[model samples]
Target: MRAVVQRVLNAGVTVDGECVGKIGRGYLVLLGVGHGDTRAEADKLWGKLRGLRINEDENGKTNLALADVDGEVLVVSQFTLFADCRHGRRPSFTDAGAPDVANELYEYFLTLVRQDVEHVAHGIFGADMKVDLVNDGPFTIVLDTDSL
Candidate 1:
């Protein structure tokens, strides 16, 4: 599993001109499932993502966790994160998980997060989605469960 986590003032996902998911003062997560990803990977990444000290404290230091700041999270399925461009101009998505496998893990990840976070939002698993966010501090981090 891989995730691009961005600290956002607000974020929303729109599909077919209808807003599907939205959040405020938290993370805008572009999440991807690799071909062999499992619940273990999802668990590892979720812990790190939730504990991230990206929000500002009273001293202007990045010391607050999502819960501490009363933030929300918007998770978007993004198979494109696994794009392979090493070979040619066009990227290959063979490295991404198959639809069924990816969707299962995606739902599992969302379940795990929803259990812990006060507020959670998510995009449709296999939908064409448009995500928009106002990045707070433009603070972003990329996490790969393969590294953990």
Candidate 2:
């Protein structure tokens, strides 16, 4: 599992001109499931994400967790994160997980997050989505289960 976490003032995802997911003062998570990924990996990744302290505190120090700031979350399935581009212009997606397995894990991850977050929104799995956001501080973090 991999995630690109971006701090945003606001974010939303649209599908077929209809808004599907949205958030405010939170993290926009672009999540990807790679081959052989499992619940354990998702668990570890969520643990790290839940504890991440990137939000600024009163003193302007980046020391607050998402819950501390009453933040929301917008999660989007993004298998493209696993694109293998080392070879040629056309990236290979062999590293990405199978669709059925990936969707199951994606839903599982969303369930885990919703348990702790007051508001959690998500994009449709396998849908073409358009995302818009105002990046807070332009802050972003990339997390991979292999490193966590």
Candidate 3:
């Protein structure tokens, strides 16, 4: 599993000209599930994400976790994070998990996130989505289960 999490002042996802999900003062997370990944990896990443001290505190330090600031969350499925681009000019998505399994894990990840944050938004699974966000501090974190 991999996630590109960014602090955002606001974020939203649209599908077919209709807004699907939206959030304010939170994180815009682009998540990907790769082949062979399991629930354990998802759980581990969720734990790490919930505790990440990426938000700014009163002293202007990036020392507050999401909950500390009562932040919302916007999660988007992004299988391209597993794209294999080293072999050729065209990127290959063979390393991404199968659609069925990937969607299942995606939902599981969302459920875990919802447990901690009051406002949890998400992009439609397998939909063509347009995501918009105002990045706060331009702070971003790339998390991969392999590196954790």
How does each model score on lDDT?
0.93, 0.97, 0.96
Off by over 4 Å in 1: none
- How high is the lDDT of residue 64 in model 1? 94
lDDT of 2 by residue, 38-57 (tens): 99999999999999999999
Per-model TM values vs. the true structure: 0.97, 0.99, 0.99
Sort every candidate by TM-score, greatest first: 2, 3, 1
Candidate 2 error regions (>4 Å) = none
Model with the higher lDDT, candidate 1 or 3: 3
Off by over 4 Å in 3: none
* Backbone clashes under 3 angstroms, per model: 0, 0, 0
lDDT (Cα, 0-100) at 135 in candidate 3: 97
Deviation of model 2 at 63, angstroms: 0.5
lDDT of 3 by residue, 1-148 (tens): 9999999999999999999999999999999999999999999999999999999888999899999999999999999999999987999999999999999999999999998999999999899999999999999989999999
lDDT of 2: 0.97
The alpha-carbon lDDT assigned to residue 21 of candidate 2 equals 90
